[model samples]
Target: MMFSATFTSLCLAAVAVALPAEKRAAPTVTDILNYALTLEHLENAFYAEGINNFTQQSFIDAGLPGFAAGRFSEIAQHEATHVQFLTGALGEDATQACDYNFPVTDAKSFAQVSYLLENVGTSAYSGAAQYLSGGTLTAAAAILAVEARHSAWVNSAVLKANPWNGAFDTPLDLNQIYTLATSIITSCPSSNPALPVKAFPALTFGTDMTAGQATTVSFNGSDASSANGMYVGFISGMNTTIVPVQNGQVTIPDGLMGVVYAVATSSDSMTSDNVTLAGPAFLSFDFKSDALLL
Candidate 1:
């Protein structure tokens, strides 16, 4: 009965809608802004925690040059500004900041979590970017650019390569974005700006490829018996479903070659994924794009 499927999809495009056309009211710009505001709050809180916990020396000790270290503080300031700006735009209707439970408890983990969050922000903004207009577009566009820069800087630190990774980037749609992100957010008191509440599995990797000879990947994060429990999400915009990774091994799409990615709770999470459900954490590595096209 699903008809009139629109394309708001990202990293994996073309989502299907089963609702009758008459029941689907188009999302207003405010709705989109509210969603974005929630994500900004998440970024702001993440950086605040990092800034509170780390010092410039922390960056130096982590092998980053002292000159580039200030970027972290700068980024924190920017995220805070974004939070303020969005809240101001929403006035009394703005979403309240909720306490977060990031995976980082140290500088090393800070770097890792920051790398993932920024990319999440990037895709979040990118996917929602098309919905804005006029003033909303102006404010968000600026933040989007900076978010990209933040990701590039961290990407370079993580990979020790050029700050820019590619000419174009893939985005995560609403469902995909929230499914991957809501896992780390421990609590959201306001709930006005709704967020995807799902317990995504924490996926881990074991070198799944060897370039030309090996184009496959493997996962070992959930119960071995949860057949079809693992799903590979790629920045190249593809969500691949793997039933039972034989001994934790399966082939990946070449389209995801040399791109950013995450291992989520499974494609099924898109609909059934609820934040309250207990499941493995989502895995988005901080190192070079995990399982890249060697």
Candidate 2:
């Protein structure tokens, strides 16, 4: 969905301000703040567009609970508050909002997108926490708790899916999350400071995917015929399972619940981003019964 130019300009004005004459070197913490602010901006705009297009009655008509719309409004407010907090924390160095294209045609679609976004947001915070310290870490922890709650509520109450994934939640690094985020984001202002990260090439599924079945996958810039020693890394919850790729296919392990991120990697270990070849492809599995929810 697209917002009006006037609305976009106003939103940008509210958050973006001028830095000092002498450009101060940004520390790791500052970069993290800006990265967070960029995500907050996207989320803030997403909710605004969704809530504006779909009403409370519309949600009920779409088979969601009566209170789902109001809860979404509250979530939107939380995202806005996050934008404000991050912008304030970064002062003049905060990143500006970007133009986006969320594919939400109706209330049900909106709820599904919200569930995914909240889970990704929670994971982003969890992954970045290791790099923070003192009051900054404490502040991020507070926000992380709220993001997790948002994910659970929307997953269970709105989408009617499994709320919790496992004993621990998954953590994704800057490049991984940025790759996912850029799928919806169209563009950002040229004046916005560059983030210290890069997005991987797109990864796609070639055939039907199931929890315990072998599936064909493709990378945008790599040849499957030459993928002799590569591996497919399935990151679910706190576990990272790496299986060797054979003829461009990998067998997904059983008992994997909720959202899982699959990446083509050069090595079995997921400890470094350099090993990531292409992916972090979005996959969802709900193996509640003996069968997978295809």
Candidate 3:
């Protein structure tokens, strides 16, 4: 009788241990807002570098803005002010200095730089707003508007478009911005990737666009031959065909939104999980294949 009782207790304890721990609720607006500030700082640094380069050019250059030097300084100052504003509401804990190292290896043109900053700033602010409330939302909106201004000016400067009314006049949604921002953050050397293998934490996945909404999707691989094994599509829509362009580029026939899927496997592999993409918002995936194998 004693032995049987002990066994029953042991089994009960084991079952308790095996059960999964309950997950905590997602973070609030305050948390998301504060976190997004860190990313802003990263952007500020990138623009500062570009602006510095712009001002240093001897005489006048085609792409350099009229207020290149002054504008960079002003933008940096605004970013600083934005940081100060956020820190006041959030405290010292809010504006944590990141170990930033943007991933874009090479950036030649002014337009490319502007596209990176405007698209990202717009997206980060939008995605972060979902988490905020009352005053924070208003503050976020204010910052978002300024970011839009930065994006606008940068776009005009780079593309030689009219500053007041550029081609991309409308603001990008959080989801769209998140995709662009995270890509730049991860690929650019100026932005930091917390985990070498991890995507940006502030990322928001693309939405599932309904019919009539034209969306363009593209992909580039590390190597030319690798393109053959790649597949890209949305979660529910017809898995559109991906056309190979040149060595690394692959274009998909789908609009921007929903959970996009990309799978790449080489000749030496024959498995679904070989190369997979996963993240908080499914922004970009990490690969696990023979080549990736250590």
Candidate 4:
């Protein structure tokens, strides 16, 4: 997983620019394959760095099972195979790996981030599958299934959180997934193909969040100060619950669980990316078994 000197120099030279929002033609099948390759590169690099930085003993000392590190190694291998598969599918048009900055300080933090990444990857593949057909769709679906398994294992075995969020998983559009991905990505090579996607303005939670609790959210860009009529859409598992934003705050609804992606939208429709004001902010709500008794 060693990056070439050329890739290193490109990362040092400049930060990667966000993809522009200009009107463009529909993405061909090749575009989709390259996009998939781009994500695979990120996931592949993430596991490589994490496993290299933290040993098996580190994971055990951090309270994870002794087998956690080895399991993650297999996940890393899956990502590498995905990178190779997509690269081969795209041939000369494949996207290169980018420089990324994952904020994993220890084995505990590494597991947490891995849980998030795997979930996002699963959702990414699911969302993009609609645009594909025939063999391409079949291949992508296969990868999506594997990604979901990785997510489930990391969530339950490593983090001791619920293995599944709900009966179904949430699907995130390309722009939404790219918005979340940009948080870790630093830069890409200048030669990398410009993806035909644009990220929404960054959004973040200003207060700690819990399910069925009120919390403050913040976002940048022209719409930052205006909360009137904006809705906080929480995409958790199979549900996209929309709650009105009042003065920068919204109360999360009850029963939502696992890695919920919150977005500020102009309307309640979760599928429409055009209405997205800002965000797709990562919010995790561990399954609460005690609440079930109430």
Q: Which structure among the candidates has the greatest lDDT?
A: 4
Query: Global CA lDDT of candidate 3, please?
Result: 0.41
TM-score of candidate 4 relative to the true fold = 0.88
lDDT of 1 by residue, 56-140 (tens): 7876787765554577888889988988888888887676765666766556557656766776787778877777788788888
Compared with the true structure, model 1 gives a TM-score of 0.69
lDDT of 1 at 221: 29
TM-score of each: 0.69, 0.86, 0.52, 0.88
Candidate 3 positional error at 57, Å: 3.8
Question: Of models 1 and 2, which has the larger TM-score?
Answer: 2
- Ranking the candidates on lDDT from highest down gives 4, 2, 1, 3
Off by over 4 Å in 3: 1-25, 51-53, 56-59, 102-111, 162-249, 252-294
Q: Cα lDDT for residue 157, model 1? A: 61
Residue-level lDDT of model 3, residues 1-294, one tens digit each, is 011112211111111011111222465554455456656666666766655555535214553445555665677788778777776776644645444334322233443444445545655675556667787789888988888787566544534332332223323323333333344332323232221112212211123222333322222312333345533322212332332223443343333222232322232232122232211122211112221201
Candidate 4 lDDT, 1-294, residue by residue in tens? 111112211222222443323335687788778878878998999999988988889998998897998999999999999999999888888888988887677898788778778888988998888889999999999999999999899877887767777788889888888877776787778788777777776666644365567767666633334567788888876678898887667887877666677788989665368799877876666664553311
Provide the overall lDDT of each model, using Cα atoms, as 2-decimal numbers: 0.54, 0.74, 0.41, 0.76
Model 4 residue 9 CA deviation in Å = 29
**What is the model-wide C-alpha lDDT for candidate 4?**
0.76
lDDT of 2 by residue, 1-294 (tens): 112112211211112122111223343898888878878898899999988988889998999897998999999999999999999998988888988877677898788778778888888999888879999999999998998999889877776766777789999988787777776777787778877677776566544465567777676645465687788888888888888778877887776677777788889776357788776776666434334452
